[model samples]
Target: MKKIYLSFLLFHYCVLLFAQTPPAQTWYQNSDGINTSVKERWNEDENGFKHGKYIRYDIASNQIKDVYFVKEVGNYSHGKKQGEWIGYTCCNYREESSIISYQGNFLNDKKTGIWKEFIQQDFLHGTNIYQEGTYVNNVREGEWKNTMGVMLGDGTVRTYAEASTRKGFKTIYRNGEAINAYDDKGIDLIENDKQENLNKTIETEFNNCYSIENYKNFRAKYPNSDFDSEATIRINKLESEKQKLILAKSEEDEYLNPLLQKWDSMPDTSKTVTFFKDYYKEFPNGYRKDDVKKRTDIIWNYYDEIKSKYEREGEDIGILNAFFQRYPNITTPSLDEWLESKIEKNASVYKSQIESLISKNTDESLKLALSKLDVINRCNRLLHNSYSLIFSIQHSLLNWKLGNTELALKEINIHKNDIVDFSSGKEKYSSVFKKYYKEYKLGYPNEKEVWKQILLIINQ
Candidate 1:
């Protein structure tokens, strides 16, 4: 009985030990169907959580043998990264040393405490790149020093012997905010000292007799300074006083000199109302004030004149182009609104005239009406008018009326092709065009050949 109990106890103990041990997993670094090397090896618990040391290898090929440089070695607990982790980059397995990219501790999968980054100088040497201060919950805390290197391309060379010499800025950050910065010679780059000197210069200028030029010079030199607004206000007041004194002395030209110069530089073709309003404000009683007011009036009247001309003359491409060129700043939608009204009216007139001609059924009258319609269509196209269905149906009807059977068939076919091409993927037919198409199709049943060609083109 004693032997039997002991055997049972030993079996239970073996089972527990086997259950505690994790299963090993191996991964390979393969490229282009070639198994370069063993990339990673680690162990996971029964829960599928990583629970042991993880190892990564950088694979490199050489004539003699395949090299596996240890790239990262770290520990994990229940799939959460924990404890010390070290990472290397730009490494050579055949050499004695490698570039330590980062070395630090991880707590519950978050980086914590100080971390040191290094620039690999050579196979056996590395310079400290930066020293990160302590981190709390992965947020950097306290002072941190980051050193920059002079060499541009990542401080690495193929030979690994001629590495970049460190010559660059050193910035100091406190709690993630850069507090101080300096170059290689240790000159402070935050410019607090320079600002103090600039402030002194501005104070000296202000102490002298009030001069507009001095204030202007100060503003130009230190445009971003805290005193900039104060300098600007002083300059404005002095200039206003000087202008009043010059006007009082009956030298009105002195007051108008700058305004006249600005007006002379204005573009000859088009000027906005706002430009003249500003001129009027600057020189309300000057010699050219009336002229500026007249220019403002002209600009305000220009849009109205163009609108009236467009309304009276119908659609004219030349007039439309001239309106846009003159009022380049004006938006197209306003013009489009006006033009759309005129276009609708023209379309109505054309439709009425075509219908009247079709009812008369006299060839001479029909021919004259067709010629007028053709001219109208040409003008509409030149103006970028969008009445496609009306134009197509007009051409088809005119051809059918003249007994040009093939031309009428071709016109309807073109219209169908356009509809198919335009009505793709979420695009529905235009309501106006759809209505016109239905009317033409139903009204022209006697012209059955043209209708058949249209149906065939649409179906195909």
Candidate 2:
């Protein structure tokens, strides 16, 4: 009798626990109790003790997106949500036909789980049928792929991209490597094949110029050929070059003499950008420095005037050609200039702020600087919108460096969506942000006072 009583008690407790536990509610089911005029069907469970299928609704469209049905309910003849439920984006009852669809199980008046949907069958899914769908929470989820090849907007069959993602990257396999797919942008590249067709263009140019005796005769024989205009232009450039050739040796000598002398006197690696830029200015079209064309921007960045002038011009092609062929050293001067300016600005702000804090109190200064530094640190931690990240990081770094790490970190954390992880689980940030963080941490005794030790390690 005692054993039977104990067993009975255990069974009763289990039953009570199961009965008290509530079913999971779909995100759509959490609506407030008011139904709009356009709402086709709106029902909420009124029974104080009801548990299964608590709410059901239909809007302008007969399309069902959300439903709550519990299979456990043996019978509620009045209903356990049997009919289709529709949804719509209502403009005060306009009843837009473009309603999103949802199909699935519902329990206890809440979407208990998975739901399928149909978005307009706009694009092809790689060898798969496409339809739109969503999960219970109304979050966009589901593959529209079917088993047959279908063409995308570009007239090629591709594994369509997720609606929320960029289409440039296409899935080639279930996991790992993806094949490169071009969108409309890829269509434009087809014209680039014109370069390969230039043979006829070149032949026509040669005949018109008559640079080669035989080709000139050939053009004379075919006077009305389609390529006459092109041939004429090539002929003109060649004649101009032939006339200019007489001055080439003298001009070449003038350009190369100074550089040759300087290069001989300087050490190979010690030959700085400053030395090269001065050489170029002295010999504007020099041939000798063309060999050491790699170091020109080092000097260019140091000279704000020249760098600024190039940027103000805003002619990238001109800038590239001017520096690359004869002065390859200056090719990336713009980038160098940008980096230098940022560093100077940041350094100046940090120095002035820290100095002011020291005048008031050493601890206050340290705290302010630390906070600014942390902000910079956090901003660098983000990957979205590089410019935004740069500003955010700079703001935080300035605050942390000025002695307010707490506030800086707090502000930067607002961009939580920007954080990402690499395959190695390490964070990748903008180079400038990384550089500043490393410097700031090393500049003082941080929480762990590891900067000094790190410096020693670096030196050793």
- Candidate closest to the true structure, highest TM-score: 1
Q: Where does candidate 1 stray beyond 4 Å?
A: 1-23, 60-67, 92-97, 122-125, 149-286, 289-460
Question: Distance (Å) between predicted and true CA of 216, model 2?
Answer: 8.4
For model 1, where is the 10-residue window of minimal lDDT?
154-163
The regions of model 2 sitting more than 4 angstroms off are: 1-243, 260-344, 352-460
Best by lDDT: 1
Each model's TM-score? Answer: 0.37, 0.19
Question: Local distance difference test, per candidate?
Answer: 0.59, 0.41
Q: Which residue pairs clash within candidate 1?
A: none
Q: What is the C-alpha lDDT profile of model 1 across 1-460, one tens digit per residue?
A: 6534533453454344334432378787787898756777788988998887887767566688665555776899999989888886644444423356788888999988887666654543444564445666675665454454221122221111111354455445554444555555675554544555668877776566369998887778778877778888989999999998777545545555565567567664545455554545655656656655665566557767766777686644334445555654443456556755655566666667777775675778668667656645543432333454556556666666677667766655554534312333322223333455565443443556665665565556
